[model samples]
Target: MKWVKIKKAEINEWNEKLKATHASFFQYPYYASGYTFFLFSKPLYIKLVNDQQQELGYSCILNVGAFPFKAGLIIRGPVFFKTNVDHRSSLIALKKFAVKERYTFLRVNANEPAIEELLNTDSEFEHKDYFPSYKGSQGIDLNIYYKPFDELLKSFRTDCRNKIRFANEKNYLFEKVKTSTDLEKVYDLFVGLGSKKKFSYRPLKSYTKIFKEGIKHELCSVYTASLDGRIICAAFIVKDSQSFTYFSGALELQNIPAKYSPANNLHYLIMQDCFYKEDRKIYNLSYSPRESGVYMFKTSFRPEEICKPGFYTYVINRKIAERIFSLQGKSISAIRTKLRSIIKLFNK
Candidate 1:
């Protein structure tokens, strides 16, 4: 098979036909603008074809990284139009391209079934363990087998259902975010949430583009839960034609009343919007660690657990890549360990 790097128009043309939820927003041409503040991003499309020039599959690559740390991120890509493409061959071709381009590593979060199968089989690629991981996401099918809204509530755990009722009793109202002022409220809450949860937060400008560019283009939407004119929680939803991903959500845990569960209520409202308004087939809760608090909360809504081979890294230069990646892992682990000790000390 031959690999040909196609243009943005071609990528859009192909994506127009595919409209798969398994893909990443990062791979979308429009989504690139939101990410430019973090890394230099270029939308790339590599088409796989046979000797007869028959189209096999196409990969959407976001070529990104800082100076002296170049990497290619492939998110749910090498989307095949036909069923006959060789996953290994296409991957090897991608590796060759990365090496030729002098990238340090090529990281892939394979979403396609064939590619996931290949990654699971213990192929040549080396796995890179990164935080805020690129693992498979949990998603709820909005169509086909999904139960009706009332049935869905019944399926939730008793405590979860009760929490929703409590939120209702609190009389929280959900509204679509429309202005820059609303965006700042969400960002401030998100920052507060990040500090409380002890996780890294994206800069405000990163979110600004998502609001201005993504929402303006109708690729995303923001909804806020409020009580007495105070925003208690907010959720950002991103969509392709087939799915609505709950990309991010922020909660003001301190401000909400004892009986109210802002997260649950906000998500319930968001899911309703996904089902009724968006008419999307999948309501993606996005990725979270299994059995974690976030995971339990998401699963309480009864979304299906989507399992697949997550992120894998193919190091172009073994010696340099190993040292760099290993150091990164160790550094993060050290910081986490120190933070935990500090927290324990404070408790004492």
Candidate 2:
């Protein structure tokens, strides 16, 4: 198999190819653009083909870090056109490409179980421990869209159903955000939530660019829930041809009553909106640890657990890669500590 590098001029064709396959949002060009803007990672689009020059799959990799210690990341991809395609050859080609480009290592978090099995069986690839990728996510089958609204509602757990109804009864206005000004309001809610939850999030400018580009390409939707003209909850959903992935969400828990269910209601509306869209068959709730409260909340929706092989790393130069990984981890930890301190100060 051979890998063909795709240039920026061919992105339209790349997008067309993606539409014909079951590629995820992470493989989309706009999604990569966001990382490029904020993280300064260079996007590398490559198409895999057999010796016969027939297309088998495509990968959107992000090349990160500096010279002599660069890493190539395949985030949730190398989306194949068919289920039976030879993933091993593709993996070999990726490794060769990374080596040829002088990368220290290559990390892949493919969405395919088969590929994961291949990586496990292969001696060259090792299970990544530090900064491991998500192994699974909760997803609702959008075929439920054909059922009656009441029947769909009945599918959820009782408490979830009650929360949805209660949220509706509270008359919180749920709407798709259209203007930039409203998006900023949603960002504020997201930042506020991150502060309260003590979690890290992308900066406002990064989110603004991402959302704007995504909206312009019809690949993203931002939803907001408000009571008395005050926003309380917001969510960002990214769409591919086959699924709507819940990317980010924030809730103003302090502003709303504990009994209020704005978050649940917002998700319900999102599901409905995704169902109405053609060819979108799945509503992905994104990743959460099985033991976490967030996992329980998502489970209340009765979504099936979709599992995948987690991250694997192929190191071209183990010594250099290990040192780079150490430094990267420390940098990330320091950043998180700084963010937590800032959030604490802001809360005070």
Candidate 3:
């Protein structure tokens, strides 16, 4: 087997090949471009081929962090076209590449259980205990698309169904975002929500590039809910051929009543559209802690829990990797413990 570096000009062809696998939007060249532009990470698209030169799989790796401490991250991928392919050989090749490039470690956070099982058995790959927040996601099966819309509505919890009905009764205008002005409005709401919730978000310029490129590729859709000429809620949904993922969203919380439910309504509309119109098979509600209010809201739609093996790291330079991991763990712990205070300082 050999690994070939795919060039920028050949990204579209690579993406087409990716569609043959169980790859998500994260492995797309556009997503890599967005991350590269925002985080200044170098994106490497590497394809694995057999001796006969037939493509077997590919991974979109991001070379991140400063030199001498840099790490390669394969987020949500290293997508293989077939289930029976030798996954171990691919990891071995990737590890060799990382060592040759002088990377401290290589991190993989693939959604595939097969890869996760392989990593668990491999002594070289250590499971990273940090970032435990994304162990699973909530997924709504869109197979009910064949049934009546009312049947799909009935699948949700009573309270959720009531919220959707309430939103409709209030004549909330829910529509697909069409213009840059609409996107700006959505970004403003996203920023406002982040501030209110004491969290951080990517800058608008990054979002602009992601949304623009994703829309051009038919891989993204932004939906908004408006009332009396003011946008109340918005969501960004990224999709592959089979599934639509609710990537990010925001709600205007200024004077909205609990019963108003624009956020819930927005998601309902999105799911409805994805099911009946887009012909998707799954609606991924994204990730949140099981104990969080966000999780409660997402569960009201009665989505099934979809779990995966979390992040794993393969050390290349043992001494450097251990030191970096120790510091990184402490830093992450400190941030989580003092997040509120940090947000306050930033606000001041």
Candidates in order have lDDT scores of 0.66, 0.73, 0.73
Model 3 / residue 110 / CA error / Å: 2.2
Q: What is the C-alpha RMSD of each candidate to the true structure, in Å?
A: 7.5, 6.3, 5.8
lDDT of 1 at 141: 26
Give the per-residue lDDT digits (tens) of candidate 2, residues 93-174: 8889888888778887777677778888889988883233222222222222333456767888898888887787787888
List clashing residue pairs in candidate 3.
Answer: none
The digit string of per-residue lDDT tens for model 1 on 149-194 reads 7776777767778788888887677888887777988888888888
After superposing candidate 1, which stretches have Cα over 4 Å from the reference?
A: 6-26, 39-45, 49-56, 64-68, 120-123, 127-145, 253-255, 287-292, 330-348
Residue 83 lDDT, candidate 3, scale 0-100:
62
What shift in Å separates residue 159 of candidate 2 from its native position after superposition? Answer: 1.2
> Per-residue lDDT tens digits of candidate 3, residues 208-303?
777777777777899988988888888888777667888788777567777877888888778877878877777888766879888788888888
lDDT of 2: 0.73
How many clashes in candidate 3?
A: 0
